[model samples]
Target chain A: MTLNWKSGGVLLGVVFFLAVALVKPIGVSTQFVIFDGILWNAINPDVVTTTADGFTSPNAYLAKSGGKYAEAVANPINYSFIFVLAMMVGAALSVLARGGLSREERAMPELWRSTIGGSSLKRYAVAFVGGFIVLYGARLAGGCTSGHMMSGMMQTALSGYIFSAGAFAAAVPVAMFMYKEV
Target chain B: MTSIILAIVIGAAFGATLDRVGATNPSLIGRMLNLTNLHLMKTILLAIGVGSILMFGGQMIGLVDVGHMSVKAAYIGVFIGGLLLGGGWAMSGYCPGTGVCAAASGRKDALFFIAGGLFGAAAYMGTYPAWKASGMLDDIAGGKVTLGTVPGASYEGLTAISGDLLGLAIGAVFVLVAFVLPDTASRSGGQVQPAE
Candidate 1:
């Protein structure tokens, strides 16, 4: 009776159905790639990836519409980006409605303090650093938890299963190593 | 136009789901990762397990396009990347999907973690050339193969078992394991049932 288990499963089913009704299976990792596009457009507009005739590279699905700087900026605003933005909005609403917005009673401050050492800056830094490393790998590997694990598994793709196995195989040991002090 | 609208609807549901399940709560995730609390595992496994069944089953009835499913190309890099992603998940207590929702739900710390993700993603994108040149990203074993191998299977010959059927069977196990795992209540404010 601790956590509400049924809601998440039901919601995922809903998401899958709606997503199928609208776009392809929903995934969030593409948002990261879009973020990369936005950053690149901001930094160096000329440094764009494209096919021979300057069309958006087919592999670069986000910018499939193809344009110059506008496309670069617009590239990040695809389905995945919208999904991510909505994710924040949805989460915000949930928190507000659920009445658990207190920063004072945040979850797992102790585990974080003990595992990564007690420093807000350190925690933020570790999260960012870890995020960066993880994203790098995720992008290289072609997906993240949602895109690879959830979406792929649903489709019964080997890549999905393989990634899941590899993730747990690595995650358990990493968790063990990181929390060794505890 | 239409895409954004769909995204909004999808995102809200997905995000709310994350919140309801305690998936947005980093502390809850941390406990799950610690292998101490097992409540979240059931939720996660159940979600994936059931998801697989529905997705494939839907395709069977033409409710979903088996072709539209986006499968990542399998390569050695995938496993290597998985390890990195897993390490990051353990360290940050947030995956890209959960992190964004967590941040939006008022987890300020998740924002930082997400910032890290952005930077991490940027690093990878910036070095895309080197990664591709490394040959690790090359598809191995004819990437995007399905788990099943029945005639007319989505991916033919990867295995004798049908991919969707296998997924359904495995997903059932996940649901079983989630229920069977010992439940321990979280010590954190966000604590849930731990195990029996």
Candidate 2:
């Protein structure tokens, strides 16, 4: 798809503003909710067990009232998660509208292919491993890149700056390695 | 009903912007990493600037509630976690949210990223006992501490004092960098861009 900086900039700004004003601020932690719901049912079925008449478990109630589990579940409903979900939907619609939804040729940089190995499966493995690492970091840090950088910075939180700096410091070198062949 | 509908619409808009800006592409993100194209940086900075001004201003005018906002504190675990995440981003080219976005847009690799993230989260949960036993969770400190909390101050007082300083610093740096950097087309790479 054709891309231009000016339009891109304006669009990002508009969406970001609307996100904060209408939906919620940008963040990636909401995905954790979907994850939590899945986990709660799987790990401690008693915690999430539903009664025949549709009452949730007492443990689920207590867990939701206070604890790390509660915190995790709460995040999914926050504005940040909604905003991120909106972003995904928006992105898909745009591609479809532009007739750019067709499968394009897979482009691989030589260095990346060599280092990560040249199969889509290998690349996916890398993506999965990488995603896990980043999310784990997000949980530990109390937020993801968008929450820390975009939302946190807007509030002038010091942690936001630290998170952004740390993310970039790690991103640059790896980016160089990943894109060297390109 | 309104919030949910607003959510879907807004989410669509956000996703559209990422796609249009080529942010959905790992190569574009990688380019931002290499400092060749700063579109992502610019977009990010501009978003921060605009959002900050709006939020801060809203707070000042009683349109927003600053006190109700949630903020995480500084902790050693966060530092270590950030480091690991940064390294992963550099290595894999995707983050959590963007990974979902990319996958939704039909990028195969992003699906893997999502799976991996699920597994990693589960692993962390499974190992919680060992992690806590290791004292990793002990004595962690920090909770909603802002500049206003640091000293004798009112919310308005702190906002006035810090806002000017941060605005000036961030604005100046953004202008300087934008002026200095030349736009380059996105790089072509095999990796799918992760959500940030």
Candidate 3:
């Protein structure tokens, strides 16, 4: 459980794919739609009809598809969100197993220190900013990295490639700039 | 029922692996942003390789049905969203999934990222009417098309043959590069301080 890059990368890929193949494809943003669909139906059942199969009716489709106000309150737990939840559990187990679970000082990059104004503050800021960008992009793009790149590419979808390329293109330069000051 | 159970198990495993690999740490991810650590890149590549082989191979052997998968094409949105996401990643050091993982690991900063994301999502919902009226979601044609549809091949053909072959090649390249590359601070040499 040394958590080297190679092993970590391989594990991530394998676990992600297994999740897709065995259950559902890995996506981070799909939760929004599913939640939206459920909520819309719950509030105004008339506005959101239910199919004979127990799925959301066509009336609610727009909210689910477009992620309107009603959709956000309906379903609190989405599949992708659940997947994210699992990822946290997995990460915690990994840390505990490695005996790295204590809340202690960990090494941080210098640029981060300057940006957040404090070591801990920087972590929150980075997460907030990153999440905002990612969620916004997920909304705009209609999917997140796991949905578009990982699962999409697995099925050979053309858009997946485009999204993946874009992600890497952005990730590399930014990563280089931030880490150089470390 | 099976899928849900499987999802929970797999999700836990995925999260654990991310944590073990140091992916839950902002600094580790930041290293990738700075190019000091190619670990993230290598991890992504390897994941792609492994996933391709498993999924495509399962399809080829008739063990899995690839047809049930959903692939939607929101071309304009993906493009613009990607740009914004990349910029944000540069400024912040975490992604949605990693940010959540970081927070779960008791990183206080990750909480900010989570709060920011919730606000952003809520904000998007509140402003949906204007965005929809602005026609940002219109005129989209691409839906579920893959490499197989472009040429003389079918989806199965592309995934089973071309996709599989390419995945293997890419995986091999990653293995080669990882072996040949020198150890940087992010790779093997950096001394990780005991968790606080």
Candidate 4:
């Protein structure tokens, strides 16, 4: 049961509008940082410390923004962190409610099958490598598609436009090169 | 307390919307980027355009608070990172948000994506000091500036044009482009077929 792209677009727009209109813009990559801090702090007790000022970390990245990241590490139950977890739950619910994957979804995508037919293992490896590159870039940029491009552009932030240009600039060429058959 | 509840509701809605739109499907994402199919691209453009209109329009009439606007700082690193992200996106078919959502949809492969993301984030953390020393993080191009002036917003404008109106204009253009775009850029790739 796939949604029509038009309706899906409008619905996605409305959701984004409400989020920005109400509390704050939606972001995801920062949560990755918080996740790292949580893991790092678990391994090393001194990585994060609570002080009168709230929270601080020995690591500069976690300690930057006036210990904001550090505070999130110390208190993982914040709005942004919970939001990421909730996103997962929501996706799961959507799939479950639909009964099961449609036949189209269950099989290898046509493009993948046609161009790079291989074991699921190969696809999984590619996905992992891709995720790593995207996340690493997101960290360097301080946001991902959600934070920098979508929300940022909606807010008319200059950096958002620049990021979009840079993203499409690289994405289009890479996709073209990789999927020559299609 | 209220914010936390709102987060769940919003985040869920966000994720469900992504799933319904096929953003969680790596294959579909690949098709979109490859220009084989433009369905997802149109959806993305339309969504951004409509969302922008509502937001900028709401702020114009005081329905949305100007102070709530969050503009990310501009820096050379952001642009470089964006280029890297684009390359990765073309290769992987998933971004951070979509990767998480994809995993939740019971795609075992997405789990590896998540692990990779975690490792990537940690790598960034470990190399943070070196990045900082490189001065790429330093703000540039009027740091946190907007395209046009937004009254009461903390960020400065690169131009004196009204930010709200500028946003609306750009949003309208996006909507127009979305309508004009075809389903597929290539004739051979008119419609994606279901796997046999």
Worst 10 residues of 1 chain A by lDDT: A55-64
Model 4: per-residue lDDT, tens digit, B1-196?
A: 9989999999999999998898888777887887877888988888899999998999999999888889999999899889988988888778899889888887776787888898888888888899889999999989798899888889999899998899899889878988999866763635554432
- Per residue, candidate 2 scores C-alpha lDDT tens digits across A104-168 of 31333233564456777677677778878877777666677667766666656656666777778
Please give the range of 10 consecutive residues that has the lowest summed lDDT in model 1 chain B: B185-194
Using DockQ, rank the candidates from best to worst: 4, 1, 3, 2
Candidate ranking (TM-score, best to worst):
4, 1, 2, 3
Chain B of candidate 2 vs. true chain B, TM: 0.72
**Which runs of model 4 end up more than 4 angstroms from their true locations?**
A102-110, B187-196
Ranking by lDDT: 4, 1, 3, 2
Better of 1 and 2 by TM-score: 1
TM, every model: 0.85, 0.77, 0.77, 0.95
lDDT of 3 by residue, A31-135 (tens): 544444455456767644434433333442244545342333344454555666677787666666677644443333344664434566656566677777776
Model 4 lDDT tens row, A1-182 = 55776898889889889888888888998998899889888989899998896888888889888899999998899999999999999988998888856554444444566678756778778878987888899999888899989898888898898888888889988888777663
- Kindly report the root-mean-square deviation of model 3 from the true structure over all alpha carbons: 5.2
Candidate that scores best on DockQ = 4
What DockQ does model 3 achieve?
Answer: 0.50
**TM-score of candidate 4 versus the correct structure, residues matched by position:** 0.95
Best by the TM-score measure: 4
